[model samples]
Every structure is written in C-alpha cells, then in structure tokens.
Target: MSISEQEVRHVAHLARLQLTEAQLRQMTGQLDTILSYVDKLSELDTEGVAPTTHALAASNAFREDRVAPSLPRQEALANAPQHNDESFIVPRVI
Candidate 1:
C-alpha cells in the first residue's frame, strides 16, 4: 500500500490543484499511512458476520408512502413574490 510521487501528481492534476514539492511529499506519506491502516483493518477475522449497511443493529425506519390530497393552487401560490396564472416568475438566470 505504498504511494508514489507520480501517483500524487496525477491525483492533483485530476483535482485541478497545484501542489508544491513539499506538499506532494507530505500528501504521499499521509496517503500511505491511511492505506496501511486500511490494510491492517483487512486482516481482522469475520467468518460468519453478515454484511451490514450500518455498524449498529438497526434497519430503516422510514414510513410507507400514502398518496393523499395536495394543496390547492391558490394556497400553494399565496406566498410567491411574483406568480403568473399557473407558474412563478423569476429573474432570468443568464
């Protein structure tokens, strides 16, 4: 899991960043350290453990979707600063 100067340079180029030589060296060392830590984590044993989306024992608690009545057009447009017959009028973006 070693990082090279050329790899750092390539990453920097892709990110549109200009790093000094010293910064590149520092980033290389930091990235290598991070990768080494991840490699160490990969050495842990997890024979029968099921893969989970979260670390805790919890599932999604989202409510079921139930379509109902919607707001009236007049009520929905009441708060608008400027609205036409059926749509809002905003300043031109370009």
Candidate 2:
C-alpha cells in the first residue's frame, strides 16, 4: 500500500503532532520506503512453513516455583523516604 502525503498529514493531525512542511515531506518519503519494503516481503514463497511462537526451540527456561526466605519488614522498609507504622507514606493525591 502506497502512503500519500495527504494520508501522512491526516495521520499526524489525528495523533496531535505538529509537523512542518519539510518534516511532512521527509516522513512521507520514509513511510513510502517502509511500505515498499513490506510489499517486497509479501512476495516471499512460504507455503509449508509452520507458524511459531518463538524463533528458537519451544522450551521453558524458567526456574521451578519454590518458596524462598524473604527479608524482614524492618529491612524492607529501611530505605523508605517516609513510612508510617507498616507502610511507605506519600503525599495525598485526593
């Protein structure tokens, strides 16, 4: 799909970005180049290729779920800028 200058400008306006005329021209060219490359990619022949979730072998590399020792509450709250009885205190929002 070819992206036109008008279309780019319309998209920029919708995104609430103010683009100069020169910036619009440059962006239009860049977008057109990207779309052309995507068009080239669509011409590849991959009739038997299987869709995959990952590029490498499908295997879990995560550690086993196990309970571990945790720091005490005083240690955890040691670095707090401000704290109440049991939690960090921040400026009131509302």
Candidate 3:
C-alpha cells in the first residue's frame, strides 16, 4: 500500500503538526515504505503459529515476600530541611 501526499497532510493536521511541502513529501514516502514492508510481512506462511507478545520468552524473577520492620518515622524524617508533626513541609505548588 502507498500513502498519498494529501493523506499525509490530513494526518499531519490531525496530529497538530506544521509540515512544509518538503516534509510532507518525505513523510509520504516514508509511510509508503513502512506500509510496503508490513504488506510483505503479511505474506509470510504461519498456519499453526501461536501469537506472542515478545520474540523471546520472559518471566518475572520474583523473590519471596517476607514481612520486615520499617524504619521509625522520626528516623526517616531526621534529615528533612523542614517538617511538621508528621510530614515534610515543602513549598506549596499551585
């Protein structure tokens, strides 16, 4: 499939992009090349292949979760430049 200059212009407008004539031409060619490559990929034979999210097998390497004592609040706030009774007092952000 090929993308036209008009279609590229429409897409640029939708994306709030200000493309010059030269840029529009370049983008149209790039999009055409990308679509052509995708079309070629669609011609591959994979009748029984399962769809996969990634090319390589991946799994989370999780450690055993155990309850641990947390740092005391006073110790955690010891280095704070400014603080109230329970929390840090940073400058107000509108």
Candidate with top TM-score is: 2
lDDT of each: 0.93, 0.93, 0.93
Screening candidate 1 with a backbone cut-off below 3 angstroms (N, C-alpha, C), the clashing residue pairs are none
lDDT of 2 by residue, 1-94 (tens): 7899999999999999899999999999999999999999999997999988889897887999999998888887899999875988899998
lDDT of 3 at 9: 94
Question: TM-score for all predictions?
Answer: 0.75, 0.80, 0.71
Candidate order (TM-score) = 2, 1, 3
lDDT of 3: 0.93
- Over 4 Å off, model 1: 90-94
- Residues 1-94, model 3: lDDT tens digits: 8889999999999999999989999899999999999999999998999999989999989988999999888987899999885998899999
Off by over 4 Å in 3: 62-66, 71-85, 88-94
> If both were scored by TM-score, which would come out higher, candidate 2 or candidate 3?
2
